[model samples]
Target: MTVDYSLPKPELGAPVRVSPFIRFCRWGLLFAGIAYGMKRQRTLEQRETAHRANLRAQKVIWDEEQKKIATQRTREQLLQLAKDVNVPIPADFDTQYPPA
Candidate 1:
């Protein structure tokens, strides 16, 4: 048996004008970028949901405080009205009167 290793080989046509392998790599990179963008959008949505919940809780607390202040103001005004009319003021007028 004889081995044909005597002659050396030449380059094949200036190494293919444009490589298909490079194009496939570029497409893979593009797909990865798209996936990252989608994940970021979902993260933003979760943050917004949490922020909205916090805002709602704060609003409820503020509303309760405002109601207390309004009740106090009404009680003071009624006491003044009673004094002006020479009427005896009740001790528990706030508890008895309905807030408008």
Candidate 2:
């Protein structure tokens, strides 16, 4: 039996070359994805900032409301004290006097 030691020759044809247009399209798609990601990040940051501002505004409003409530309570107590001392109840005092 004769042993074959010769290697098979490779087939020759036009070299496999990537088209420039295809390369351009790939690069364009990559850049478009980066731009989209950057835009999305900016939008999210803006939304977060706006949300924080809204929360701060709400806190300020709540603090003001608390102050107003405290002031009303103090006024009511003063009016009650005046009544207890036999002082004349002013007609303009609109708060309902508590039962003794």
The number of clashing residue pairs in each candidate reads 0, 0
Model 2: CA > 4 A from native: 1-15, 63-100
Which ten-residue region of model 2 has the weakest summed lDDT? Answer: 91-100
Give lDDT: candidate 1, residue 61: 99
lDDT of each: 0.86, 0.86
lDDT of 1 by residue, 1-100 (tens): 9988777777577555667889899999999999999999999999999999999999999999998898878877888899999999777775676555
Using TM-score, give the best candidate's number: 1
What's the lDDT of the predicted structure labeled candidate 1?
A: 0.86
Clashes of 1: 0
**Candidate 1: TM-score?**
0.51
lDDT at 47, model 2: 100
